[model samples]
Target: MKTFTSGWAFQKPDQNYFKKFIRLNNIAIDGIVYPKKILADIEGIPVLGFDDAHDIIQPDDLVLDVSTNPDLRKELEPFFAAKDIDCVSVPDYLDRLLSADQHDALLLPVAGIKASDIRKLKSAPIPDRFDAHFLDAESYEVASKLDGIFRHSQWQRLVEFDRDDPTGNVLFNVLLDLHARGLLKHLSA
Candidate 1:
């Protein structure tokens, strides 16, 4: 069996219906594990810092950090669907599955969001549509900072990993898993 894991520090806890879907499909999950210092409580869901999640991922589990680019989550939707992968949000618990050594998985970083078009938006006019979008100021700040780092350091890391292991499709696999579970709403055209 193959499984993929992903989590977004910004993803609302109430929006975790995807968890039930993955369980119904019997997919393995790897939730993002973070150090205590970076942890924050968001409506009761434990959110981790992007750097912390990246630093602690296990090699054997397919890990995903969605803090970098929310759109990347959309990009990955179809791929996870075709592959029939399972998704998980936590990483430490995922280590338990690694002990079996019977499954294949991918580890994805939330770093890819750096490559997204958010930079373009800085100069672009704010969409009239967002007037009613209710974005909190703090969320905006965190996302802006994360995007900057992802474009620089995180993007470099992902490129290096891909260059070293071209056969691995961590990003694609996670996208597919999200798609399969119908959790990939952002990607819908």
Candidate 2:
């Protein structure tokens, strides 16, 4: 039972590949500290939304391949090392992260919008319709801003498909199989 921890900053189109990988691998994941208002849905997947990764990570669990940001990696390295936990590189761990059951259903369309659009939405004023739908005033305000940005930005164009249309399961199983085979190694001892 390997537990995985990741950061919320990795929640983008290019990085969704890893998210789908983790979901398919059936790896229990935690330590994504995303704001609730920002998350569209997790679809009952086990997740912890906090302000920081340090809040959710324990010394015993493994930290998966994170963003390219060196500062964040540096901040987390000591924590994992102190706990005697294994920190695996993203490339090495990607396979195991994609080995979950293929029965999970897709919720949103298998496409991405632009980051500029998303940014625009995030900055936009909250509409009455959004305020009513979300119920929470704060959520409505935040969502409007996020919506604006997501709709306007070219960044959203980066999203990739998460499943095979025919099988309805994640398309990347070989990565997980490799991880299960002990081909993956820890970044820190």
Candidate 3:
């Protein structure tokens, strides 16, 4: 599952701040996966709070400078509550962002490849050096994989053929380059 929190750096409580925060908030709310827990430290407890601001924090807890807008905060509460996303004050959100780990779900409205997929590219030939590297062993391996899959399938779908293989990254990257160069026909989503 993906995770996300709303964060907006505000100089003052103004129309611009509200507009920007709403745009950012929509991204979190409309996401395929919302954060299940909001990071917070309340009353010496490392608390995970949900949409209810009162449940997450006490008045004694210091409110963030960025979250001073009661009007915006109040407006956002219901939207967050409807989506069941944990809401924290901006200060807590900032802290959570800084300390966020791989397991920590951030808002992911769209799908993206994992870091492992990108790392796979290193084992593939640098595509532009085609003449020098084409005859090399690694380049030959990449070419074989590319020849196997070409424009016959989507890169993501094609990668499933031994998707974990390093050569798969080369094939995928080459496909992207080909699509970029207008050599391959791109299927519209």
**Please, what is the whole-model Cα lDDT of each candidate in the order they appear?**
0.41, 0.47, 0.40
* Residue-pair clash count for candidate 1: 13
Give the clash count for model 2: 42
Model 2 weakest 10-residue run by lDDT: 100-109
Off by over 4 Å in 3: 1-9, 13-66, 97-189
**TM-score: which candidate is best?**
2
Q: Which RMSD values do the candidates have, in order? A: 21.9, 22.6, 17.3
Using TM-score as the yardstick, the better of models 1 and 3 is 1
Report how far residue 130 has shifted in candidate 1, in Å. Answer: 39
Q: Which candidate wins on lDDT?
A: 2
> Model 1, stretches more than 4 Å misplaced?
1-17, 23-30, 33-38, 41-46, 65-189
* Model 2, position 10: C-alpha lDDT score: 47
Worst 10 residues of 1 by lDDT: 106-115
Candidates in order, TM-scores: namely 0.23, 0.36, 0.21
What is the C-alpha lDDT profile of model 1 across 1-189, one tens digit per residue?
223234444354422433432454455433433333344644344444435544444344454433345664654444434344333433322333333323323222342322123334334554342354437754554455544433333232223322543433566677778987889967642
Which candidate, 1 or 3, has the higher lDDT?
1
Stronger candidate by TM-score (1 vs 2): 2
